[model samples]
Target chain A: MSAAPVLCFDLGGTRMRAALLAPDGTRLAAVEAPTPAREGVGAVLDGLCALALRCRDTGVAPQAAGLCAPGPLDAPGGRMLAPPTLLGWRDVPVSALLGERLGLPVLLENDANAAAVGEQLYGAGQGAGSLVFVTVSTGIGGGVIVDGHVLRGRGGLAGEIGHMKIAEHSTDCACGAQGCFEALASGTALGWRAARVMRARKDGTPPPSGRDVIEAARRGERLARRLVAEHGRWLGRGFANLLHLYAPDVLVMGGGLANGFDLLEPAIRAEIARSAMPSYRETPLLSAALGDAAGLVGMAHIVRQSLPDLGRERKLG
Target chain B: MSAAPVLCFDLGGTRMRAALLAPDGTRLAAVEAPTPAREGVGAVLDGLCALALRCRDTGVAPQAAGLCAPGPLDAPGGRMLAPPTLLGWRDVPVSALLGERLGLPVLLENDANAAAVGEQLYGAGQGAGSLVFVTVSTGIGGGVIVDGHVLRGRGGLAGEIGHMKIAEHSTDCACGAQGCFEALASGTALGWRAARVMRARKDGTPPPSGRDVIEAARRGERLARRLVAEHGRWLGRGFANLLHLYAPDVLVMGGGLANGFDLLEPAIRAEIARSAMPSYRETPLLSAALGDAAGLVGMAHIVRQSLPDLGRERKLG
Candidate 1:
């Protein structure tokens, strides 16, 4: 028989995903929904409660919920405070509200922190004593895990690696910082570079998205390849900076770039090998093993570990 | 009488310092000696033993010895694993040897790590929940502190912040990496920049050291002020990377250049203010209160915490 489940939720800008996980982190069932962000907080909360309630049908009542959303959260207060991704989200009492709605205990975690915890507990970061999980997506974000616990910096803003000024970049990032690694090498930056290349093709040529650029590069298109290479180099520089700064045992690369690991791994590895100190050169760079489910899985694991009283909660009849 | 003491020693390439510390981290009697580095391992060990033994006459058999040395240490095994600054030393079983000689246990820590520990305990970092101690001396080094513990990375090499590739640089660092923060902004780099300016001698200007340049800047030398300003800007870039990377509660600047904190702080603050995320903009950057004594005090603090049994040993008999 499968073990009792843990509730997990990941709230993104446009979507909300809820899942049930067995003791060892296997997904029992999952439910997804549009975030209803434009309709305001109450609608979003209602949607989340409905999605979580969907997981109750597997004859398993999760003891506690691990609610992960974009952050700059007041974890002690169980609130999300002004995260940019979710407009109008300020001082959200996420855990408490969800706990009352679901009639279960709740633990709130920053999405990146949850992902790192998940990787440390059940994915590529398993057995790694110290790890840093970096996701190079629409924007760069990360979780710093050391000795099996996520390091929640002073305000839980510790591992914002993408915003680090790793080099001189002419472009400005959405974060109001110029030359951030995110501005130089993130998926958004890749699309920006692709658009620059496509700008001259005024004869009804559509501007390529980040995914289109990656596909073109895979097809060996010269301009796309150049853009991808530049992205890799910038990523390599960012990786080197992370290595020197944290010197984690393993660096797990997540986000969309992980899907194209084959194309970017070489330049990233070469840059780190040649540039980081000798002691940091051997840090294994691995792809995120749990893929898109990392946040859901990680949030569950975090709730299980952090809320030990969860075991005392009722199981669904 | 003061509370029991903690024995402390800081070993450098040029000198060795040993001191006895009261429980509150106040310095009692202290002694200094040449490092005996040229005499190889045996002589160096003997010198350290003699210095530590000097503290014994205080009618106080200290709890345990905290030995600070340049590293990539095997702190668990208590050994130094070939730090570049310390020539011809490798695989030295420091803690065990010192423990055997002193008849008390020993904790061997990287110098920067020890300094960080000391600061967290009693210096500028007092009451700080998390701190990152950065030393910009002949070489750049740093120690990350979180939750009152020094972050000893996977292999005790975690806090090598100087080796970070935070910006572009033309010179090769001692660590074999080009454009490392150390290569771009450290005292050694400052000297390199100063020498280049001095080399275009239409006048018989003597090539100055890094200190000489700083002194000249203080004396209002136009060229010297420019050099210092450039160095400060690079340091600012490195600071911005660190602020984003670690997000520590306090950033303590130490080492020789810290003597000129006035010259560097504004630029560093400006850089971080302009580039770092808004959440990280207010990170408190402070001068290292313990100064040259930081390494000694930090080492002792680390030992006291790491080896609880040391408290069971002699407490100033």
Candidate 2:
């Protein structure tokens, strides 16, 4: 293994995160910048290149670099095939472009898959033998780790948990599907519910934001509590499906909503217990340990595996 | 690899299957018999031994023997642990018992995992990088093949697909769960639906078996057709969930209902297309190529991996 740290970048729709990770999985330095994603793919690429160069100048000219972002993607080909959240980006050759710009081999992975790997290697799933990581964010995304290797399925595009049609009549998804888990459960869906409840309130209650709803639930807001419980039920239902299909040793929850896992976990666990096969009832579900850093760290881990010849590969640029 | 033939057995609750397989993947002989399962675990063991002795008497004593049955099991320790379908079979040291009786090493595998391994080596999943297998029979069972290995999860009980919650208000399952995929869409569930519809019929139609429902649907009986369609919808929804979670290269469907797959395929595929992530529309759902032979063949396949010293380890007993 290279002793030099791996530079990791997590590219989101609104934020660009950068980190330098040591060979022993330690984070040395990290920073974040606004991602002007609306400026299109070119601007995003430029931002990524600048971020890597900044990391290099700060004494972490990485042996390699890892990038994590949303999909529909070609992970093996290192291309983004028009992720729904990122507009005007289609078949972007991310890895090649970064490799050329930074003069270093770059590995790209689906953000959720990266986070799952990071958690499996260093977070809540550290001791678990097999795991399924679900991130219930604006939408749901999943990463499945079995026997230490992620199940990338056929084309490195595995683990898209949100689009699964768990509900027969919930709502239509942007993906043109009805009753998807994400359509029914995600943070965005929760926010939509909260807004609708506020609109229908005869007592003239103020509309709560997703964060506000979570906070109010904690503070004993009845409507907020009911809505969040509904979210938890949806989450639990999805988790039950996963437990049945994978029988994972652990189910780890990550992403923004996981911050209030204490509120969500009980309902999720109850659903899993009530829905999963008896033999699978013992599988533990835990909150992610790395928090926001998971994407960067997971990308770093993927980089080591994907770009094995990082330092030794003949540099073209 | 050993050139000697391996004896493989698939011990189901109702039937016993055996085969002699050469190392080159050719079957020398195949045999079947009634399982005698109702007589309890000891009778099952004696029946298995009798089948092995019959195989030996007919020609070659196997270099090793592999047995595939239901979960929960200890594959590493070769013990059967309280499988619901196998009454009174609790922590039976099957491998030890079989080895003692046959004077050869014995290997045990969960039937689903065995089927998955079978597919990877010789069935529809051959040459595929990853595959997920689901058997929609009286119950739902899942097996995952990632890269070239069967994903046994933490302890050999990974891939339990049938119990995933597909319906929010599905009936209680024998495993003491409600809303499970099995409770909503298994062959048994389909039968139940047919019976309920028949009871509600003004024309006084007889209640249908699962097979009868399939035949009636094929003949275009409206109620039967509707029942099949509903079952297909559930199957599709469940597959959509599985697709999002695993994104497998290919999904192989097996079990008794697979015979009517032609009747079920179109609706299932259509529902999946309607419910899945847009990018995953092209993922294939296929009928298993190995048929009922998968269990027996898979046993031989897993034995070759788990007990490397199968032919070499001779027992005087």
Candidate 3:
């Protein structure tokens, strides 16, 4: 019998990517489009409908569809529940709407979780049973896979590692929390710090982006270097907390900031090495292999696994 | 048919409790013994052997045995790895040794992880699909349960919540790290804080125990009350971190300090309400139902789940 194919969609705050995956996890076809999130969730659904129709026109019939989105999403309900990234997406019935529009089964997952599943099945965490995937882009996001299953708590809201408090008495978090790890180590936070340092300089140099901060640090800019080191230190602090709390065998770092992981790896690792339980020091920390496409591939797997009725019954275990 | 029985032991630094639970999760008999851990792990093992004999006397044939011990213990290898409480136990093959002595399969688990499994299957988390158990006693311990499986990291060393960094610029932890949750909000830390404040009194009053601090707070002792409140606030800070990271539907608070949870609930919830992502504001913070017995029962469930050759398997999912 021929293996079933699933449609995978990775939804970012601004862009959307679609892919077709065969049962053995082959990416057969792929395409991209703008999310149009500011036009509201209804318009975003309309865009997804058009994308799904376009993918269908490429001669591959999708047995099921999978969508990965910014979370606080309710995976069980296939709903996007109040994600900060998707404007006007409060309590949106994402999977149901997509399934109805496309006339196929659909599964919804947090993008980080999808990335984690992607890493575990086809990327850095291949063959690993327990893993934690951290995406450090504009913001820090994480997904935990334990005993070969995504650890989705009630309402499918588990794996919110970015918000874990790593710094004590530091800046306030966007979530109204004081000293959240995200407020210190996220890419946005790093950029914000760099810009603030530049503005405070007596030399009156213009502020820079997070990437510019890395470049400046490499070029021996004292404040920029300090900012990067501080971010790395906090990343290490957060990683230490994660090690203590999850103890996963593999920690996979991904997303845009990871492109220059060397800038942060030393200080980040130093903090973890100095702080985590000595016995757990052996756990490997590596860079994600799939990069941006991890979410799409991960969502493909989620569709296959969650919608067994679609008939691709390969055992993940 | 009568259900097979399993022998379970909860081994603490000072106390050890043993019980026999039927496959149906009924406790046939249970007893407590002094751990004498200061004498070293050998004496503790001997005590375990004696406890096995006691279980035999109850006429409940234990097909398998499980021990809930302080971790970095190896669950798969069944070894008592270096645990803080078991100072002398280093790479001891506890399960194999006990299996040989008792003529039954044996398994080992971190006490908190065991408690989490026990709670999920038989206590407050019984009906819940996923949960995180946090126990704030002399120290803090945490366990994560997802999809009815206990998450043991690569080396069976997951769930070390107490060691997570809480304060970036605070005191050192027992694990040779700075600003761990254990260093700031554990009962041990609470006692230390109370003692430090009392020592500064001109009246030469000795520092009180953690329980005394709680009592003093109840009696409106100004300094003690303030310190206790501060401890609760710090604890709340850690809880906020846990909520943000895991997003469990229920947060089960256990251990000795949880006895005062009623008094501390408001402050802890207030902190979490203020610090956590707005979406997680509603997660329940409740006291554990099983208390010390949670460890023993959790051990039984571990044996039932992990050792299929043993007859006590049906109780586990």
Docking class of 1: medium
Q: For candidate 1, write residues B132-237 as lDDT tens digits.
A: 9998888888999988777876877787888888665568888877778888888888888988877875466776777888888888989988899888888888
lDDT of 1 by residue, A1-317 (tens): 22558888898877899999988788999989888887778888899888877888788777677788876787656899877777788888887788888887777888888888788888998899889999877888889988877887787778878788776655878888777888887888888887886786555667776777888889998888878877788888888888777778999988887777778888788877778767787899999998778899988877767664454543431
The TM-score ranking, best first, is 2, 3, 1
The DockQ values of the predictions, listed in order, are 0.68, 0.69, 0.70
lDDT of 2 at A194: 89
| Whole-structure CA lDDT of model 3 | 0.81
lDDT of each: 0.81, 0.81, 0.81
Interface Cα RMSD for all candidates? Answer: 1.3, 1.7, 1.4
Superposed model 1: Cα runs more than 4 Å off: A1-4, A37-39, A57-59, A96-105, A198-204, A220-223, A308-317, B1-4, B96-104, B198-203, B220-223, B308-317
Candidate 3: how many backbone clashes? 0
lDDT of 2 by residue, A1-317 (tens): 56779999998887898888898888787878899888988888888877776776777567788888988888878898888778798999998988788877778888988999899989999977778999877788888887777778867777787876676677678788677788888878888888887787756766555667788899997888888888898898888777766668899999878877899888888877776656677888899999999888878877877555654454433
Using TM-score as the measure, name the better of candidate 1 and candidate 3.
3
Per-residue alpha-carbon lDDT of candidate 2 for residues B138-234, written as tens digits (9 for 90 to 100): 8888888877778777677677777666666777787786767788878888999988876776558666678888988888988778888888988
Residue A21 lDDT, candidate 1, scale 0-100? 91
Which residue pairs overlap in candidate 2's backbone? none
Off by over 4 Å in 3: A218-223, A309-317, B310-317
- Using DockQ as the measure, the top candidate is 3
